[model samples]
Target: MPVMPVDRRTLLKAGGALAAVTIAGCTDSPSGHASPSAPPGPDVAVAPDWAGFGRGLDGRLYRPGGSGYAAAHQLFNPRFDSVQPGGVVKAASIADIRESVLFARKNRLTCVPKAGGHSYVGASSIANGLMVDIGNLRSMSYANGVLTVGAGARLYDVHAFLDRYGRSLPTGTCPTVGVAGLALGGGMGVHTRAYGLTGDRIMSMQVVTADGVFRPCSPTQNADLFWALRGGGGGNLGIVTSFRLSTIPGGKLGLFILKWTQSQAAAVIRGWQRFAREAPTSSWANLHLDARSDGTIAVRAVGVSTTGSATAAAAQLESFIGIRASSRSFSQKSHLEAVRFLGGGTSSPRTGFTAGSDVLRGPMDASTISALVGAVKARAGAGMTASAILDPLGGQAAKVPTGGSAWPWRSSLGVIQWYVGLAAHPTAASYNSARSWITSGHRAVAKASAGGYVNYVEPGRAIQSYYASSFARLKTVKRKYDPANVFHTPYSIS
Candidate 1:
């Protein structure tokens, strides 16, 4: 979803009414409420026994021309609305998930699972295929310092549920992202440096593999699958029904945002990198070079300190920057307060944007930083908004031993996201312009970047770029679990 990279409030601040698409299978709170109906799409042809298949499921099925078909197929990004699924199974239980998989395998139909519908490449939905929508399977419980969450649970609901027990999980800022996708793709967020990626905390999970078998994976049972499940990226090995993860104590955190003019971007970038590298594991800061509505870029440092005052953290950052911020704000906030503050305003259920990423190998030199700053400045315009966001990754995230999980970039500096939010109705030319800017940004940092983050997956990018050295092992696991390649996407292991 690039939810952590491109802030929706920042996108709105760039100035434009976002093209609205009725949201489906997503909610900002734990409570369930009826969703607005979407105009039904054209009737689609279906398998002869599709009705019988629907009747056998515990959850409701939405075939094309059905009441919920349009809403059932919607994803977080409206950019891929053209690729409509022929049918959707809103799985209500693990049994429903297994049945859906079995049905798809027997029918020889493409099957994809839709969690939070945040796939950057829209892998959550398939064209004329059967979609096993797990959004209805959201269920959560916390006991014995472990939180067990249904695969469909969103960040907001998860956090809310945990807050009741004064527990927290390392998660991205965006509240609507599915826990399954984030944890599976090596979740990175404000808490990354202190706690490590969300995948690192996963102790066990329940999955419905391609062969329609329900399996429990943990360090002691189905160990190989357990290793692969963490940071392997969802939809590659199976449909995850639930996850059991370790939790951290919820308490107050120091939050701060320091800003500087674009003139100070290069200096700020250099200084931020040094500070981030030296900052204690309890502190984390992300640099954002955002294109404003006025055709100028804004440089800002946003971070959190779990153990000290926000003012002290800000001062420490300033000491490294060697320059005073034009403006800054620091405060101590409770865990829930911090979550809401960091979530920002404008949590649009749907957004129009194209984003990609690069995982930094190490600190970038002055020249490379200059080129990156110049790239964003050159891309700023009236119609679209561009942002260069870098989230630090070296603290406890790197402590995981080699081969601890499928995530390969733990030893890296951070993930650099190149993002552009589009206009109400973007033309092909506009999309080309946006993509070209992303390409230019990539070229600027290609020397320092080792690979791309799987969560921020992009089309045409090599699959190996995401897994790196782990790709071979992942392919082996995939072959063993799904030899027929029934669970497949453009970037899925073959």
Candidate 2:
């Protein structure tokens, strides 16, 4: 039977109404309830046996036509607009994942592995394929300071779980980002300065390979596969079921936010470059410059340190900008709190936003910074807020051996992220500005950096440029793992 088409306006109206109702009275408190609804997209034909596949060995299947399917498809990134999978197999156990992969391989259909659904590029969750939704695989076990988390688990959940034992890992700030994609793609977060990317902390992984075989991977066994899994990007190699991560003792961390005006943009950026290079590994900073409504520029300096003392870190960072703060938000927060602040708490829904990223080895000159700021200032709109974020690299990030993993940008000083939000219809002018800013900003920063971050790439750019030096090796791995290129997406090696 052909699937019935729903009007785009109707879908939006329905989704908005449902969201408002579900989130109406919910507070931003950590204990607030999460609304369960299907992601906004056209309805697709689900297989007749979708219900059977949804059932676990325990006999409970979550079906797309059922209530659970609606809730299960709601992931963190909202840009993905394709239909829901023909069917969703909500894997409640590792065995379920194995069974689903085997079934999909035998049937000769495509399969997309979904963790937290936080894939900004929409690769984590797919449309019209066998969607192996892994949200229910939320088991966590800790022993001897090593934490083992299920792939379906979210970063915030891991933080809360480990916090009980006074331990933590270097995961990204977005609480909802899946551990599978982030860890597999070289996660960068608040603790990266002190501990390194989340990939560095991974001790082992329980993976379902492309051939439908289940095995444990680590540095000693399946060593080549282990290298590929770390920073090689997810889904291509296999479905990662669980991860064994190294954890550290939790302690107080300092968090500070300093703001500046457009007039001080050049000075602030130059100062940031010097500080990022010289600051101790214990200290980390992020530079955010957005356009204001009144036609002025706004620059915010955010930083965190392993040392409990904010005084020194703040002073060292503040001196570089050499500008008085228009506004400041600072606190001494636990690792969890720091993660929440950096991730932009639950109040801000991840909706209608387009973001792209690049890595920088050095700093942009004053003229480039000025032009970039002007582009952003002239393009502000209701749903549109264009800005750039610079995340410091080096320290432990560079210590990993060259060719140690597929992650190529170990020597990078920081990552440059360009993003814009859209509330209403995106006009040609708005899109043009975004493209121009991203291109110009990337080129301006590229003089200092060689390439871009794979996870944050926009559509239409060459994959070769994104991978740069590591493309050859990654392509070889792609051939070994996915020889037929069955698992292709925006940034797949193939």
lDDT of each: 0.75, 0.63
- The TM-score of predicted model 2 comes to 0.83
**What's the C-alpha lDDT at position 415 in model 1?**
79
Cα displacement (angstroms), candidate 2, residue 416, comes to 0.8
TM-score of 1: 0.90
lDDT of 2 by residue, 1-494 (tens): 00000000001012113111100000000001111122333343553455455544442344457767666655444434334655567777778777777666655556678776655455554555567778788799999999988888876689889988999887665556667777777777666777887888888888887677797888787777788878776676788999988897688888776767767777888888878888888888777777545555567677777897666776787787676667666678787665555444532354544455666766667776676566665655333456666777778887783326777787777776666554323445655655666666666555565665655545446767666776787777768766655465545567
Candidate 1: which stretches are off by over 4 Å?
Answer: 1-48, 345-347, 381-384, 401-403
Error of 2 at 3 (Å): 35
Residue pairs in candidate 1 whose N, alpha carbon or C atoms collide under 3 angstroms: none
Which 10 successive residues of model 1 have the least lDDT summed?
Answer: 22-31
lDDT of 1 at 170: 83
Error of 2 at 284 (Å): 0.9
